[model samples]
Target: MARKRGREGRFVSTVEGAEFFKVYLPQFSSHQIRIPPDFTKNFRRALNEKVILKNKDGKTWYVEVKETPEGVFLKDGWPRFVDYHGLKVGEFLVFRYNGSYSFLVQIFGTNGCKKEKFGPQNIATHVKSEVESDNDDSSSVDRSKLFKRFEEEEEDNNNEFPKRPSFVSPPSRRKMLKIPEEVMNNENVHLEAEVNLRNAEGKEWPVNIYTMLNGPTFLGRGLCAFQRDNNVGPKDCCKFIFGNQTTIDVKILRH
Candidate 1:
């Protein structure tokens, strides 16, 4: 006798599902979403307990699948899962059931606003690209492009940091100081390290550190998380320590 073949992973979000996500899903703290009954029954019948949902960018979340009177539903981390991917009301989510209890989700955003390529991996790639650009003598990497990459990785979507501000006079904030040339220019500092700026309270803030072929180094795009956290404004003293070749500690001396 022939063995029964397993169900394949193919599911598309309907208008109803999109409506459910935008209209009502955000209201609940449980962060559960009702899976379409027909799709679940036909394609996901084997989902007995829980499953791991992963997006195209490799963000994974463990979601509980509960079989209830209404239908099979995904709970626990559903809301934040969608939010992290910047899913909107009109967007469509395509699900492909990969084996090993995971679903590969592809997001179809509205008006061609693709947010999938801007993951943490891309951020690392962006920094690496700068390192590559350092090879050519005539071409100088655009600082704006670097900042744009940082903007893409920013958690605060509403207020993306602007390009580095130029202050005509002293302003009301603490400013970040540059790392010493000895350390920044070291042959060892190319792409082997990730510098962290630490506050007085010992909070570590990560920043992208890369060197150019010319004699210039940038801490991060415009104003990085460290600057925002302590209100590092214009002309304030910001001190940093090279904990090691891989990490650096920052101290906001004054605001």
Candidate 2:
């Protein structure tokens, strides 16, 4: 029997029961609802109860309070664990926690039939701030807005860590490659190298080289180059072409 109190059928309006007045029907009890976003609210209050959030380290935990931080996760499993792992810091985690006590946790990330490991480091998580109070007619939450908030928070956390050296990408045809010419100018640097590119059929084609690093810079700046006729680079002579081709091995020998 759906009642007008609490979450119980919240003010059913339509005779078919599919619709309601004020708010949707509550699956829980009369005055109790799901937990508030603040985390301090009683998650198990009224009809809804605790939420089980799966962390990236492979374990589930009931989050009664959520003030620790968003990306936070528990790893290696906590002894006498409160479920399993908790999202504490570092990586971006998918964070499989029930958005609301009334609804079961659903897949909300890039996972497509991919058994989620909870939260993934460096990847972003989506949290929807989209819940409107049943009693209130003016206010409502949107999921998209919540996701943006999560991204901003993630950036703040990552900025505090040391920057890692990013690998330079090989230039494609028509792209200019910048190489450190200054470093090469120093004869002591001594890096003798040559590359010959051939087609998959073993046909040698004239290749071109555009940008070479003049030298290494203190600001971590280096040089690169582009590809053209009469130029040869590593990407050209391969066992297979990218996208349509498979990975091929290359043997470099000193004559």
The per-model lDDT (C-alpha) reads 0.48, 0.26
Candidate 1: Cα lDDT at 6 = 54
- Cα distance off (Å), candidate 1, residue 253: 24
Looking at model 1, residue 228 earns an lDDT score of 71
Tens digit per residue, CA lDDT, model 2, 1-255: 322333533332111212111111223212222233332222223322243444332334333322233321222212212111112222122322243422223232323332343321111111111111211321243424533443454476683313222112222222222223443344433221212234333444222222212322111001122123324454322111111111111111111
lDDT of 2: 0.26
Q: Give the per-residue lDDT of model 1 (tens digit) for 31-131.
A: 67776665554444445457777776465666677777877788755654654444446666666666555677666666655445422232444444543
Pick by TM-score: which candidate is best? 1
**C-alpha TM-score for every candidate:** 0.36, 0.17
* Clashing residue pair totals per candidate (backbone < 3 A): 4, 49
